[model samples]
Target chain A: MRETDFIGGFAKGLKVIEAFDEAKPRLTISDVSKETGLDRATARRCLLTLAELGYAAYDGKFFQLTPKILRLGHAYLSATPLPRLVQPYLDQLSDKVGQSASASVLDGTEIVYVARAAQKRVMSINLMPGSRLPAYCASMGRVLLAALPEAEARAILEASDRRANTPFTKTDPDVLMEEFARVRRQGFAVIDQELEIGLCSIALPLENARGRVVAALNIGAPAAHAAAGEMVERYLPAMREVQAALRQVLA
Target chain B: MRETDFIGGFAKGLKVIEAFDEAKPRLTISDVSKETGLDRATARRCLLTLAELGYAAYDGKFFQLTPKILRLGHAYLSATPLPRLVQPYLDQLSDKVGQSASASVLDGTEIVYVARAAQKRVMSINLMPGSRLPAYCASMGRVLLAALPEAEARAILEASDRRANTPFTKTDPDVLMEEFARVRRQGFAVIDQELEIGLCSIALPLENARGRVVAALNIGAPAAHAAAGEMVERYLPAMREVQAALRQVLA
Candidate 1:
């Protein structure tokens, strides 16, 4: 990353917007300044600019992002073919397995969902296109990690806090390494009550035209509904079918 | 609108990202410069900054926005209550009407779709969240305009190019004024093949908790399947039901 090549102010402006989330839907100028580590003046200017452009709205004091900000995401979705191309397959997989199916790509230490189809709400968390989860604990995350170089996967794993999200979660680096090796050999990964109790998911890597794994496709269901054997028996074939079809289209 | 209040470089950077659409998904630095009206150096810096931040990717010659860019939209969707709150109602409306139902907000001279549910495809254009259509001709657009002050509505109408997209599109200002007046009184708007031939739609304004009209909810069907009278008789009631339900939630 060359410093001369970057526009620092533009990046700072985006950071200001990103500073707001579910927990903090509205913020003051000082709040934004503290969140983005920018001075009060810079944050105030960005907030006012966003408000003026209809991307953010201010009501007296607190500033909140407006729906107009969705245009940025819409631009990416409308222009990119991956989400649209993969949607029908996710829908089919979800319908076939009677669970929620999703596709995600590795983004740094997390996997960002790009496409999702739900048959029934299985998780407490509402998973949508922009939802993200730690790469160390999610089924899709391990599949994505397995696709990366061993050194890179280890680096990401080491960087992660690697906590026991649930009693079943494998937090030890050596154990995770063994699991990643198994996932690479088996061509898929299944997490049984790892990320959360009663939440299980099975995932397989989706390859691009060059046969390089670009994303992970997964089906998540309640553990009470589908155990590890049931997932392998019922969900695996459908996932493979979708993966094969995607490979041809991607090719 | 104030020059000092705005961060011009941030706006310019967003414009650079918006320049990539379905037609031109990839571009060189010069292409971006031409598309955004930014100088070559400015475009290069923005592109490089986006690339370094993982929001974009440059394969040497062509620069394209990456899936990571969707995070911005996700941030908005996660923080905003409108889209999520309105989705299930739109799904119910789509199921009942056996057509497509959508919610949109007026943005400048265009209406941007904020939520959508489709039962069948009726048009050549694939409508989704973030998709924009000219406000002068869309049924939802007319409904939104009808909710605004007469002076503001007329100013927007005057600012629009107001071209005839189809043979039935009303480009005359006087005729449109009469139509807007009718829509305001009737509490809804119906378009009979104004945007595209064979496409008919009925729309009603969706007011937030404050009783201010913030968006429009619409149901669209093919003319062969639903006439203007049928839209009023069938679709209008369903749209109103959704709108009423939404009002409670928004409140």
Candidate 2:
């Protein structure tokens, strides 16, 4: 492709930022090259450029994203209307559901947290507005995935190379497809310790007035506190309430 | 700047996004051009590009930011380490301070909220992770400004066309300089009814490993709740504790 015709270096830089996630927060130059399919030199240039721009930091051998990098995500959040509208509701949901709540939007192949509220002293990793997780394994990702067109969802599932991140993670592509079908039928999705060993999450879609899934909101807690039946019985009503509240404001 | 230099376009687009604040969330092309000095046609293009990228929405005549713009802020919050490290502490401070707490970083002439925790049913504006306010007027901004070198701080003061945002806003550069000096001596700042009518805020700098003030953390509340003695007697200790926690995690 012609250089200008393709997504430009700025886009590529953004993609490189995306390549770093919970599982791969720090990466070597060769790891980035292999992950992003860029030449090692290109990856190095990108890393150096990112460092110069105050987005990446080097600790002798490994490159890690810096807090300055949060500015990009901050820029998006400050300029967007969704997180502002959804956060208070998520906060209230956390109180009502007695668990942590989060809203994530699909960014390429991942689900990035746009808004989140957590109960104090939770077991899972602390996720913030800019945190990203694999879309194929999390409840929020599954909600967005189930909302996507079948072919597109299938493409992501296939390209994702679903890893059994935990024992509960659904790794088989066919199983994921079936799960998507079930989620679509139920209008929500749940993960039982799929993302982390003792963490569970349940998610529902946040659609605009047009009924397009613009984001996914979910609540997570330890598997003991968020048992599948208990989540369905207790949290589902609150989640639906948030979805309705969000629709009113977002619409 | 060359047309090939997308940097200028990017900068202009950022300005367009920045032009919208809590007070002005929607503007016409002419309004944006007048506000940003980019002319109508250029402003239109930027708005259109933003719309195409799902960062903005336009109703032919009036343009407003889209919820999708949250991704920009989300990108930063997820990648940045400082705010993530500071958040739980802010949550604790919210309870200790008996009001809302926010952590902000300087973005050009603005202070972007990277993290916030508000008491329930306190205010209408839900300050999420990416909200931006003019740095010159915010208590958080004063803490940051107080931390700057005298020459650089004076230069910014001279360049700033201090507008009277509220009856309580200090628009005089000389008075603001004295105020900055006082803040520097005391190592904190309290702003009363300046940014908004009922809102009062107190802020302190968050220094990095290099002892540079990289961010500011503040508590805000209605004037009635955050009286001067209460801030000194109750909130300061909590703020200091949060600052200590922030240094432990972020540094």
Per-residue CA lDDT of candidate 2, range B57-116, in tens?
778877876544545545445556766678778878887756888898875566778777
Report lDDT (CA) for all predictions: 0.85, 0.75
Candidate 2 residue B11 Cα shift, in angstroms, is: 6.0
True contacts kept of 2: 0.20
DockQ for candidate 2, C-alpha atoms: 0.23
For model 1, how does the per-residue alpha-carbon lDDT over A100-162 read when each residue is reduced to its tens digit? 899998888889888887654567666767678999999999999988888999999999878
Q: Give candidate 2 misplaced runs (Cα > 4 Å).
A: A1-75, A121-123, A245-250, B1-79, B121-123, B244-251
**Docking class of predicted structure 1:** medium
Per-residue CA lDDT of model 1 for B39-153, tens digit only, reads 9999998999899888999899998888778778777777777777887888778877778889898887789887777655688766766678989899999998888888998
Per-model root-mean-square deviation over C-alphas: 3.0, 5.1
Native contacts retained per candidate? 0.67, 0.20
* Model 2 docking tier (incorrect/acceptable/medium/high): incorrect
